[model samples]
Target: MYVLIFSDAGGAAALLVVRGCHTALTAVVSNRSNGAGGNFFCEYDATHQMSNSKGELVSIRALVEFCSTTNCNSRQSTSANVFNDCNDQTTDYLLGNEVLNCYECTAQQGKNCNEKDRKCSSKKYCTKQIVHLDGGFQLSKSCSNINVLGIDNACANYDVVTNPGGVAVHNKYSQCYCRNKQLCNSGSSLGVVFTVSMLLLVHVMSTVVA
Candidate 1:
């Protein structure tokens, strides 16, 4: 089974295998128990399911068995069968589609830059490529009214370079304004003058011909 394990709170990692991706999916069995709500451990057996969505963050909960390795023996399992006690109460987090970075790869795990935390605080993700700080970049200090995505509290796509030796990830952007439709229509008045000039030119040519 293809299982992915990540470090959570208390420095515990588990390999959970799932069928689908980027969606909310679950599998329940009769011989299993569930734990408290709003917390996630690790699940490695048939009774364990990991739900990861690229659009929203789903809270994981189980009455029992957060981390389990399949039992080749017929022994009944206890709550302490996994671990004597839990170390971290809340240490791990999963991003469904927030676009904040730290993806499912080594590059995301070991990012390129972290010094410009203040600037990239809400702008770019941890997985996104960093740009070297130099000219040709619109600094975060100059941004106003940034846009927000479906899950983002602020708009996505603003970036700044802290290092001079950074690589490009996606199309780098700073900030841009979006004007209202009414304000833009006011500029349509300019087109009327051009139309009137063309009609006058046509009239002058006709009179001369007559």
Candidate 2:
């Protein structure tokens, strides 16, 4: 149990008389505080942190230094040659692999973070990109056309925030999901704005029939 409390004592009045038998275990209910009790202070290990399945943000799960980007944040795979499935351990705990992809990214489309580029090691397939949900970003280059590419043109005038009837692509090269702004029909650049609003509504109905 922490090797019988760091080998059974050495001041804090002999660890407050061995495991605080007289009460005083003062902070090691850990989230990171190795600073006041000299020599690897430790406690509170709920296996660190790993929350998912609908809380949204998927990566930061821990282990090692109680990992949230520590105990050596294992930085190697941007798509390190697409093999799949990997688990690690040094101090051992670096958590979060209950599954949803990125064991080196074959992609369930979450955190594939560019998969070591160079077109993902020449087509082992990650084609090096994973950004999704309409800034649209992920491309390994296979599908040349079938539509579904929106979110460019600077957010297409920034109106909808969440699901305002599905269809958007405001123009970063913008090309699909055109359901509004009159179906984004600028193909003829909106036919000169509908022929100058139909010639200014036929000259305001010929000046109200003269």
Top candidate (lDDT): 1
Error of 2 at 70 (Å): 18
Using TM-score, give the best candidate's number.
Answer: 1
What lDDT, from 0 to 1, does candidate 1 have?
0.21
Give the per-residue lDDT of model 1 (tens digit) for 1-210.
111222121222432222221111111111212223223232221111122322112222221223223431121223244333222222222233332222221112234323223221111212111112223221212111111111112222333222223443222332121122111111121111100111222211111110
TM-score of each: 0.15, 0.14
lDDT of 1 at 6: 22
lDDT of 1 at 47: 18
lDDT of each: 0.21, 0.20
Give the poorly placed runs of model 1, Cα more than 4 Å off. 1-51, 61-80, 88-210
